[model samples]
Target: MMFEKIANKIGKYTVLLISLLIALILYPALEQYKIGHICLTLWSLITMVAIVVSLNENKKTSKRIQLASGVLFLLIGTLLTRQVLGLSQEFLYHLILPFSFLFIAYIIWIILSSIFKRKSLGADELSGAIVSYLLLGIMWGLLYSYIEFISLNSFSFAAAHDIQAKGSALFYYSFVTLTTLGYGDILPISRFARMAAYLEAVTGVMYTAILVAGLVGHVGRHR
Candidate 1:
């Protein structure tokens, strides 16, 4: 049983490490190639599926099935702003693939929170985990959006078309909103885009208030 658990941890971390390496190094290097793009897509799909599967429980499978909803949430979130703004299929190809990878990374964070919850959490751990999760979500969202913007930005755009850069400027924009350090340089181009920005900002506020408070509450009431 010990060996089984250790092996599982190793497998999970190995995939995560590879995902990070590819996202940070390999993808950036070979980003312009068709084969590189295909490899990235395959790597992301594999990583996402592996993460969803990692929630496996020996006794009950349904509890783990909830993990699949993580994948669903990612697809919905990406497709919402993506399709609403009517991005090109070629751009969608690059955007959805990398965004999917980052979303899985976010779900992995959710899994970490679940693990922390199962262990003993003091007020410090509670505060740290809540802040970390919020920061992580915003960070991952930015990365995925940056890739989108990189693929979309063009020189021959009109003023309206130029605003597409703002949509793709997700990494820079999301953080500014999350930290409430709005620079106002990159504005939301469309209603769907504005809605996403609003949701992210609201998420930033509620995350601190709700998750942080819940952690403190649990710690305060502990036996």
Candidate 2:
């Protein structure tokens, strides 16, 4: 029982840790250190573990399904780490990375849905919701990365750097699009890229409004 409680805490705080990792990766001081690879590897591993742990905590899910999700995440994490370590070729990024993000995004969606269905709002619910928001940005960021990787001209940046040259810029553009900021520093040129940007913008606004209202209603009922 005690061990399970500890695992639950880890699952609850996973998003906060992930957010910190993102900041660490983006920090200019660490740019010279090439921390992106290590940080991203760790981030992916932790996300897998967190999702598995959360699945274990939920009584509604069957043991078999939980075990399957764990196994799937494990396989994806292995591939992701290998790619990050340079043991795998660029082809892995073209294939494995996008699939990995898609899988994790699905897991995050499940976790968020479960949290939202809870009868009362707690720290876990609030944190999980925020994590879901961040995960949306991450998912879209990976998609943009893939788009830029496949076609150098998919997006235009003011600095005119390739996606590999300034990897963080893709993530920056992701959040900018998510919040509908449209800074114009980076513009999506491809039809699909523009469509994705618009979709993210709409989803971001709706998610924020719905989550805020739901949390407020939960709190009010308890009060």
Candidate 3:
């Protein structure tokens, strides 16, 4: 009962935490402060925990899976903080990106399962849909970052910033592209980058369609 209560609390707050992350991504000016990276890292950890807690409420996913995801997220957060603080980078920080993306993808699966397992859509289910969309964008952003890192000039940002700021730039660009909002400030130059952008754009459209269809079907069936 205590665990259920905790899960419920986390589920209720999922939307608020996600909104904060989106706010930070949209307003990069807040990231200029030294504390900005810390905020982002901490927020990421909490979000991961909240997601796992909410998923556990369904009892469909195993405890081992949840624990693994939580540990992976915690590790990524720790590595991110260390990288930001210049504490450690010997183990290759970029390598962690792929794992983080995988973890996010798994989280999306859990959220989707939870959403469809219900007979009727509630506020939590709707919020989970939004979170899944956001996670998709974030996952693609990590892919873009990895591509750019491996191949120079893969993507270009209009705003001039240091190499360290590329992560934020790619994230902003990914969301813009995901929403099909071509701001033209960031351009994908390489073939891989262009392909990724195109794929994500299509995926976004398809995801919207699928989510709406699923929700409508569920509502109709229940009604």
- lDDT scores of the candidates, listed in order: 0.51, 0.69, 0.75
lDDT of 1 by residue, 109-155 (tens): 56545634553564434433543554455454554354445544421
Residue lDDT tens for model 3, 1-223: 4444754665543553465467556447655665676666666676666565556565546585586776677677677768577785535546667777777788778778878888877776777788788788889988888887778788888877665588778988898999999899999999999999999999989999999998998899988
Q: Which candidate is the best by TM-score?
A: 3
Residue-wise lDDT of candidate 2 within 34-89, one digit each (tens)?
45555655655665555555555556553644665566566656665675676754
Ranked candidates (lDDT, high to low): 3, 2, 1
lDDT head-to-head 1 vs 3, winner? 3
The CA lDDT at 38 in model 1 is 51
Worst 10 residues of 1 by lDDT: 154-163
Local error of candidate 2 at 44, Å?
A: 2.1
TM-score of each: 0.51, 0.77, 0.84
* Cand. 1 Cα-lDDT: 0.51
The Cα RMSD in angstroms, rounded to one decimal, for candidate 1 relative to the true structure is: 8.3
Question: 128 in model 1: Cα distance from truth in Å?
Answer: 10
For model 2, the superposed segments whose C-alpha errors exceed 4 Å read 1-36, 59-88, 219-223
State model 2's lDDT. 0.69
Q: Which regions in candidate 1 have their CA more than 4 angstroms from the true location?
A: 1-36, 58-119, 122-168
